[model samples]
Target: MKSSPIGGDEHPRPLIREVVVINKQGIHARPAALFVKTATKFRADIGIEKEGEVVNGKSIIGLLMLAAGEGTKLTLTAQGQDAEKALAELSKLFEDKFSED
Candidate 1:
């Protein structure tokens, strides 16, 4: 998984409002995969920040390293032509607790 792979473009980026991982287990393999799956749906560069490290939001490995334990706050950023839509979708996924059951 790459970190901040997409860059050098002069496009505006949409910053994701703080999203807290309320899920008890935080981001595990299953949820990480799910999160990346959602991020791939749009054509935008997405990034997730944790502890000052920014990882590619669409990469499973990157997301897992975030170690977003329960209540951990994450900042998602999407920049590209469709940044708004991508950011919205990504945020929605987090809001849904990665669809954990």
Candidate 2:
């Protein structure tokens, strides 16, 4: 059998990265909204995973549901032509502490 590309596309594999919540407040409403905003800007399909539970990266509610507190590690996945770029930007948000200081 032929192997299929991720997200039903020609992309070899979905870009995956592990990020830790560095913000003091974690992914609360503001951060969730920002995350969703950023994720929506990319054409790639994005998903945020916490302990195996994955949620749509474009959904604010989904992000908020993770309850990803400070220091919590999460996995981010993206599949599409811009998968690499998407993951880069998304992971930057985590590293920047969502700009919440």
Candidate 3:
């Protein structure tokens, strides 16, 4: 939940957030598509990390490759003018269980 600027003042550091997948089905195709769709709405560069693997958040294939399941913890990183807003919306998706039951 900490969004500190890194790389000094010259560069905007990516905002990082830790979120857990709470949906019953986790991040399957539908959820991944939803995530990518939402991510694409922002100009920030989005990255989703699980364990040590990081993938572009706007790529549905990348998201599916993570194989993240319920209770899985993922790190979301965004860098750009709307980085904070992007992280907030993305994290809200996780918090809301991707709008699934």
Give all candidates' CA lDDT scores: 0.80, 0.88, 0.91
Tens-digit lDDT string for candidate 2 (1-101): 33335555556578899999989999999999999999999888999999989999999889888999998999999997777889999899988888878
Q: TM-score for each prediction? A: 0.82, 0.87, 0.88
After superposition, which runs of candidate 2 have C-alpha atoms over 4 Å from their true positions? Answer: 1-9
Candidate 1 global TM-score: 0.82
Model 3 TM-score is: 0.88
lDDT of 1 by residue, 1-101 (tens): 33344564456646565678878889988888988998898777889998689999889989888888888888888877667788777778778887775
How far out, in Å, is residue 21 in model 2? 0.3
Best by TM-score: 3
Indicate whether candidate 2 or candidate 3 has the larger lDDT. Answer: 3
lDDT of 3 by residue, 1-101 (tens): 33345643433789999999999999998899999999999878999999999999999999999999999999999998778899999999998888899
**Candidate 1: minimum summed lDDT over ten consecutive residues — where?**
1-10
